[model samples]
Target: MQCPVWIFAACQSLNNWQQEAGSLPKIGVLAIQGDFLEHGKMLDAISMDWQEVRLPDQLDGLDGLIIPGGESTTIVQLMDIYGFRDTIKRRTREGMAVWGTCAGMIVIARKLLDKRPEPLGLMDIEVSRNAFGRQVDSFETEIHVASIPGDPVHAIFIRAPIVTNVGPEVEIIAEVEEGKPVAVRQDRLMATSFHPELTNDTRFHELFCKLSGS
Candidate 1:
């Protein structure tokens, strides 16, 4: 059978990455709340070192940041209390690659269907909170990302948000059905409505590392 184009690209990327293995990108996981440690472990599994970003100053020496899945309201409230909201927005615009998963996706959206905790409005996308039902409705499914190689990624959704629309600059990388974007990217910003850290797959994280330009 003919190998998929993405598989070839993945192999090439992995080879290039291995050649530069001596210098992997420095990554940070937002640690105020959510599954930050899980993301850190995933990075460790990929032989990458990462710091836990709690204060705004800690965000300084990072090539990329991962906002793990958690309660959006609680995380937003903590961000406000710890004065990370404005700084995060500022740094992100200054060319920091950020990947938001699940509730993190909700935090970066330009608009939310419900008017609750205001979003950071970093990514030009609209999201519907808990669109995949509630905690009881959480489930897993295989998702294919064109840029990632190998089999489809198994994603876990827990009180996950859904990407309803994306702006002109946003590129939809993965979807569940026709016109339903599940993962999107714009410049250095990437967001996914499911938790990839919850699984053993590291391709998504690797893709984010590449986007970080490190």
Candidate 2:
């Protein structure tokens, strides 16, 4: 006897689910500061395996890492205190993917217009911190991203940074204004000026997971 169409479809769906579960990447969320818990919840919603990465050693075996939105200066300070600067760079060189959001973007940029906190110099982009003004000036808007399909993404900018310049390798994913980039990707590295974790959308997280080869 042949399987019914609906039964076949259900079997295929179950097989896909099993494959996805088997290939789920072990992601790490930087928990030294910021909204790491929110990112963890987002990962949970996607049914991806993830954990809070507090120390540099926690980075081991992680397919990807997320730097959550918070105080850029404080995040950088804690990173240095925990000896993460070199270790993270090394991991990235070894093909570990990284995604940064809001202040996390500021931490990973190659250059920052403001002089103070030292960036990890990961992504080849220059950023202007607080380009959208203070927390009170925070706003939400829908923007189209080149990599994400379907409708525009709902971006929440809270004291966001804007990409002042991008290198040849960097791909501009989304922008709020002409000539200003809010989301960018370079190989396995990604950065967003808005807090995607604060919104209901999981496309950005899905994109990062895909980029991580999960």
Candidate 3:
């Protein structure tokens, strides 16, 4: 007996009937910080879904998060005001990946050398905030990504942080000519002392997404 066609189809479908978690990972950008819109656009260009995480619920099921570059002090203040610091800590601790670029690095620094107010203290590394001069000293460079496909990435550093001290678990990825650490990765988390979103190149973000498996 052949049984019923629908019954056979259902039997075959049962092996692959699991529901999807929805479109690609919902990347969250801390809107309270600087360059949030810019990063949002980058995400859109890459065809990845993203949202400005201004509330605690926004971080609920994000596959990955981005703390965009901005003023460190003000960014931290907003994080506290919106109660995102605690949520970020919880998510990062539970194996959710995070990428902190420029001022984002300072916000997640566990040990900030500069004499600024406390931060979210997310990463376990020491950072020197705003190593580059103020607005006048802002500069851009083509950074070398060891595993990238083509030429180095064009990174824009506007009052970016300098990773002077990375913990044993942290792996330094890229640096400037002066040996200033620009990119560092600790497990699934990543931090850059520059703003990749501000550049036309998308290597940095692609690399980050690859690492996040999203």
Candidate 4:
């Protein structure tokens, strides 16, 4: 893989990227479930300001929040139970950047291919829950994300979802060689099937920060 070139040159190093710009953003990680702590650690390594959101009140003053990977159905239920569903929808609509990985992709999708229930429907694309099936089927591949800071990103898909169909307005940042959409961006919102936090590919996350203006 030749790898897609990174868009933001300032993002050379995750930590100093913000310092070079002379600002650190108030980022958030949805703690509704699964692999969220790893995201937090990634944020820390990048030297950006962030917090874990578990309540409606935590939504205040956040530039953006990453909805980490996990079981899709459970995260939505938790969002509803915690009164964050509407808040999340409203916030993203109001221009608060939202980034979701795996199950998180399932949550923000406007339509789910599996006929499952409870997606927040913040984005205009359609998604498939566990489109690749169980974790045992997990695999790695090099992907091209035009907005990132390096060559082809080594994407690790663990029981990941696939974005089957996309709306006209969505920008495809990453895709498989077969041309399946894997990462997308619409205004302040972004979602990916693979987990960038699980790998050394800080470009995707860093590109997100650039796009998000955080």
Question: lDDT by residue for model 3 over 188-210, one digit each (tens)?
Answer: 88899988887765556656655
Q: What is the TM-score of each candidate against the true structure?
A: 0.90, 0.90, 0.85, 0.89
Q: After superposition, how far is residue 93 of candidate 2 from its true place, in Å?
A: 0.4
lDDT against the true structure, per candidate, is 0.84, 0.88, 0.76, 0.80
- Going through the candidates in the order shown, the clash numbers are 0, 0, 0, 4
Which ten contiguous residues of candidate 4 have the minimum total lDDT? 1-10
Residue 135: error of model 3 in Å? Answer: 1.4
Pairs with steric clashes in candidate 3: none
Candidate 1 on 120-162: residue-level lDDT in tens?
Answer: 9999999999997888999898888877767898888898888
How large is the C-alpha RMSD of every model relative to the true structure?
4.6, 5.2, 9.6, 4.7
Candidate 2 lDDT over 1-214, as tens digits, reads: 2333423433343346548766657889999999999998777666668999999999989999999999999999999999999999999999999999999999999999986688999999999999989889999999999998778899999999999999999999898876689999999999999999997677788778777864
TM-score of 2: 0.90
Question: With candidate 4 superimposed using the best TM-score fit, by how many Å does residue 133's alpha carbon deviate from the native?
Answer: 2.7
- Model 4: residues >4 Å from true position, as ranges? 1-22
Q: Which segments of model 1 are wrong by more than 4 Å?
A: 1-15, 18-22
**Order of candidate numbers by lDDT, starting with the best:** 2, 1, 4, 3
Task: Please list the residue runs of candidate 2 whose C-alpha ends up more than 4 Å from where it truly belongs after superposition.
Answer: 1-22
> Candidate 1 overall Cα lDDT vs. reference?
0.84
lDDT of 4 by residue, 1-214 (tens): 1223332243345445555767766788999798999888766555567899989889878878899998888888888888998898777766789999988898899999877866888888999877777879899988777776457888999988889998999988888858888999988899999998887556666666765565
Comparing 1 and 4 by TM-score, which wins? 1
The residue pairs that clash in candidate 2, if any, are: none
